[model samples]
Target: MEEKKIVSIEDRIPKLKEARKKKANRRLLFYLSIFFLLIAAIIYLQSPLSNIKHIEVTGNKIISDEEIIQLSGLSPETNIWVINHKQLKQSIEKNPLIKEIKVKRKLPQSVQIQISEHKIVGYVKSELEYHPVLESGMIINKHNISNKGDGPLLINFDDEEYLKRMAKELGEIPDHIFNLISEISWEPTEKNKYKVVLYMNDGFIVHATLRNFASKMKTYPSIIAQLDEGEKGIVHMGVGTYFEKLEK
Candidate 1:
């Protein structure tokens, strides 16, 4: 009886080893299958089949879609997953007029871009040309940047830098005050102060300087509230706030 039991134990041990080997082989095959599938997925995503097929651009009034595409160097042939977003932003920033921009990939082959442009509050004339002045008081590049409206034209000897500075502050100023401003001027004189010679559309001149523009201008809404229809003249904000006009 003991001999028979030993023979049976030997046979059972061999069967167990065979089962363990079979299980190990099955696990190895499963892992390898998953690995190959992952590689195939990666290749598909990187190929043209998953490349950028369309492009959408918005919030671009100053820049056109074609221009954005050209500036970003993005096209239908570009791969969405492989494209570098930082490179695209740097390319668009090349345009000095662009204040801010955004770029992104929209799955399965699409790219989108959004942009905001610099605001033009006023303009300055040079010899025979003009440059648009930004709200920040900086001049934007324009060969013949001219305004065609019923407002005061700035006649400044040193308008180049002022125009650039003015351009930078356009969006920061209140819209009503901006529209009320008819003209701005700068002189290359002893006090090269950025003086704002505002001419109201309603026949009044605003004596404002760019130094404390935001804080000083904040008092304007209240001042205009106290004015009468017949009241018209210069509102001096440079020093102590006051309003005056030439003897009629």
Candidate 2:
């Protein structure tokens, strides 16, 4: 067997140096990668690519998209990362017509606004124009009677309190029954100040008091079902529920 050769510490020193250099190179590459990533992040945040480029509004009827966007307090200059959704929603909901709203950020650079408006129950006539009345008791003067369909017509009822009560009662009734009502005239009597007459689209008249209009009118379908199909007249639920057939 050949004699075993002894390796000097000087020979191992070169290998140790090469290993240290490799470790340092790896560490330097890691730190450089981290530094470049941080710089890229800063650039992405400050660039116009991070700004809001699109704003979309939906579920608006009376209010226009431009009007809603103006109310939202959001502009093209706004940064998508710093949007306060709650504050923006509150601002848009300040309009009486907007019952609810939602704001969301789409990926890249876009914002979406969803709105739910109050239900328009009827219209009140003033001169030749008709103002739309919402379920929240607000009257929108933007529309006229000609622009509207056959909704309730309020006669001699201008009191906001009374109108609110009327609107509340009308809202409680089912849509099927509510749609049948063509006109409503508030005619207060000495005995009952809340008395009103409803003219149905089916050519039948409804006499009811605002006190229990919703409760009483709920039985309207059953009452009409019991009557003859050929018969048409007045349905009186003002005091006790009864029917009066009009003789030809």
Candidate 3:
């Protein structure tokens, strides 16, 4: 029995073709894997599901989410990449009532908006409804009226700027001094010079004119310091700032 070795170009050619086919298949698989990975990374970065996936809001009272979204130009489909957050802030702050605002972005697609709303230091009485007076000297006739029962109520005048200035004074006077019975009247005594007449919530009267207002307000604590609770008389600050004490 003789062992025979077989050799033929036809047989070798088929083997060579099979090897080449296997190498080509492996390279194609490698290229496909790289392409799919690149696509996955891009989608992860740009997809709404992965970017800005959550939204939160805070510091909003009368302003609703819908109102904020409308004013901010933010929506469920807003693209986080191109959203100009600074511009959104400017638009939201356009409302006189909004004092401050802050926005933050989180990883994996989340956004949060924090807000600071204006406070009602006092109120302005309108025809049917009264609006909350902001500390910054703005009046809105739409907010629910709260009875701030006795610091100073401006009546018979429509001076928005003066009302805001007066509201700030309420914060200066101690609560105890404020409780001293009073109604504030905005009477246009002469021209642009608006004078304020104070009615003691009690029976005494305080004549307050709008001049160096904050300075005059500082005198109230010391001035009232001497007056008795029952000394019901008119304390005047209109001319040269003096109190006309009436005998009990």
Candidate 4:
């Protein structure tokens, strides 16, 4: 500056007051905003908007959605924020069919539950009604004749111990090979109590034992591949793998 200009107190006072006024207004607006936000949050939490309005269940086949939801202990009135996901999952898993469950909360008031059921590897006929045999070697009660499952049918399997063993063995078989099996009949003798006869979908009869059945049957596809097309025979899979053609 070329010269020092003395500012009057009155002139500087208005500018200082204007700055303080602006700062105070900003602080007031901030406090008001915070207060309104708190009020809105409280209102939202108290309103039904915070309640679970929608519940979706998926990945359930044998267990019905209604049954799954009922097992979850969740309803429209249940609050999404207060859900105990672990407890709900444990509750649904009490059913033997239910292997696993996942519970998740979707924002704004919805919940999703996913269920995984045990796989049915085969079916055992009991009194003309076939019951599903799970991969876990457990058999469930029969529902209806029409509901007889898609897997291979087990016949003449009266002993629970052997049936469990058979179910476990069947579980290890690959789906492609398992599909080829139409029926398995238990024909135990004094010499070999684990004897089983399998009727294949390709018109081949298989004579196998429960011992090492899964390991031996894994080669069934390859065995059938080497045979002539539309060939019907008895496949001996015990000590040695061979074929005996039927007299057509």
- For every candidate structure, what is the RMSD over all alpha carbons to the true structure, in angstroms? 4.6, 4.1, 9.5, 3.4
Report lDDT (Cα) of residue 40, candidate 3. Answer: 97
- Lowest lDDT 10-residue stretch of candidate 3: 142-151
Q: What lDDT does the true structure give each of the candidates?
A: 0.70, 0.85, 0.68, 0.86
Q: What would the TM-scores of all predictions be?
A: 0.76, 0.81, 0.59, 0.80
Better of 1 and 3 by lDDT: 1
What would the per-residue lDDT of candidate 4 be over residues 1-248, giving only the tens digit for each residue?
A: 59889999999999999999999999999999999999998998888899999999998777778888888899888878889988988888867777888888899888999888777777877677767888787888833222344788888888988888898898889888999899999999999999999998888899999999999999998888898888889999998889898988
Per-residue lDDT tens digits for candidate 3, residues 1-248, read 99999898988998999999999999999999999999997886577765455677787775776677668877767766666888989998877767899988765566778888765455556667655556566767553322333335557647666776776665555566666634677776555365777776556677776665556656666776687675656677655766677865
- Per-residue lDDT, model 4, residue 173, is 90
Q: Kindly provide the TM-score of model 2 when superposed on the true structure, using C-alpha atoms.
A: 0.81
lDDT of 1 by residue, 1-248 (tens): 45553457777898999999999999999999999999999989767888788999887665667777788998878777778888888998777656788887788677889888666666666677656655555555642222242223566626456555554444566777767666666543467467766666767777777676767777787887788778777789886898785567
Error of 3 at 96 (Å): 2.6
lDDT of 3 at 232: 56
Ordered list by lDDT, greatest first: 4, 2, 1, 3
Clashing pairs in 4: none
The CA lDDT at 213 in model 4 is 94
Worst 10 residues of 4 by lDDT: 141-150
Query: Would you give me the overall lDDT of model 4?
Result: 0.86
